[model samples]
Target: MKSLKITIALLLTAMLLACAGNDELDGLTADSGEQQMYDQAQRYLRNRNFSLAVRGLQLLESRYPFGRYAEQAQLELIYAHYGAYEHEAAVEAADRFIRLHPQHPSVDYAYYMKGLAAYAGNTDLFARFLPTDVSSRDTTHAREAFAEFSQLVSRFPGSPYAADAKARMVYLRNLLARHEITVANYYFRRGAYLAAANRGRYVVENFQRTPAVADGLAVMAQGYIMLGMNDLARDATDILALNFPDYPALDDDGNLSSDYSLEEGQQRSWLNRATFGLFDPPEIPQFDTREQYE
Candidate 1:
């Protein structure tokens, strides 16, 4: 009974919303011709009234599906959604346009806008104002954006947006590598040495040429050392020496350095000292690569 009542309530609400939307469209395009409606939408776009522009464009497209300006209106709707910060909506609109008009001359623009929307959605408003590390956040949208941009570049190398897409792809690739390194750092902190080493190896193998590659090597070396995998640690250190000789975690001899060393003559706490540090043993300093990013 309760579920039926809820369903009925939802249906009535949807009907009311549909009626309200129709009423709004009727009022906005009362006696306006197709061109006049399009002009009104353009005015909204020019004035930066994105929400109104989206509404007007949507109405115009629905009222005149066969009108000369129908295709243009669909394209503008995508931009209006983007301008209004409805990134997901913008991506959906772009997809619809591409599917409907695959051979459209401006299809490259739609692809570019789709990728841009996903990229913008990933960063969001909070990330702009906050001190959060983007690499530590969920990477779903970032991966999506990268894939979309990659598609744009692959399918339309001559596109005006190709260069910018390529640039963004580079950043996204680095960001992804950094995320892997960040996870490895976390695993190291938690004493999951094997897990950390695997993460570092994954980054090195998959995210070549990224800035985080150096950090990945550093983490791998440290994790292997912690796990008593001396041979693997030496291999990682040798690679680090050849590639990133000046990495902060390495010393003059290219060996891992303990940055967590105690100051000279600094003693343990009274309880620890009395227990000869058996109860609270000093932690071995782990090689941390996070300092570079910080």
Candidate 2:
């Protein structure tokens, strides 16, 4: 009996609001109605009906742009867009909220979501885990994601999202570092010795702690050797052997022994197989070697 009364009351309220909406889009945006609509949207959000939640929030914002719940509705709208996989819209909404309420206590949440949107906005979700060299790929979104996360961490160390933001930043930095190494390797393959060497040097200079540093050192040494810069080659070789003792670039005597050549580095390429394109490649390369990057 109580449930029936509540249902009838809600129906009447909706009918009243609809009539009020006809008079002015926000004519029903009184305090009581605003709370009711916002509460209904919260229910939709809790039910994971993000589309419905989005509609409710949109109505809340449009009807009472300056309502007490307007800011909170905008925040919820961002989440609704994100939950629905509307990544670009989520980011745009986040940006708008941040701009409008720079001093709002919840601004850090907006920043965090901005980074999350970019991180998850890659062309394919699987691409994030693919073995293809990132240097040959478009990493603009990744870089932007990193920047957003970085800002949140740096500006709000105590933010609830700070720890996760730091971890993500580390991953992005490593990814960017590896990209340089891959590009260097590709240049070496294309017989652009100078470009390859320069790329290796960039990684060494910019990305020290990453695993790519070992490869960078090897590429640099090989590039110098091929370019007839024996002294520089020797320096790179020595440093690599010293730091990464088990590195494949080193020989039994802990000396640079292998001639790093593009022809030498061709192992199974994910890009080549992806030509198989998820269904099956026309030909899959034999053997998956972990150390194939050498």
Best of the candidates, lDDT: 1
Off by over 4 Å in 2: 1-32, 125-136, 259-294
Q: What local lDDT does model 1 show for residue 73?
A: 95
Model 1: residues >4 Å from true position, as ranges? 1-27, 260-294
Clashing pairs in 2: 276-281
lDDT (CA) for every model shown?
A: 0.81, 0.75
TM-score for model 1? 0.80
Which pairs of residues collide in candidate 1? none
Candidate 2's displacement at residue 139, Å, is 1.2
TM-score, candidate number 2: 0.73
Supply candidate 1's per-residue lDDT for 52.
Answer: 75
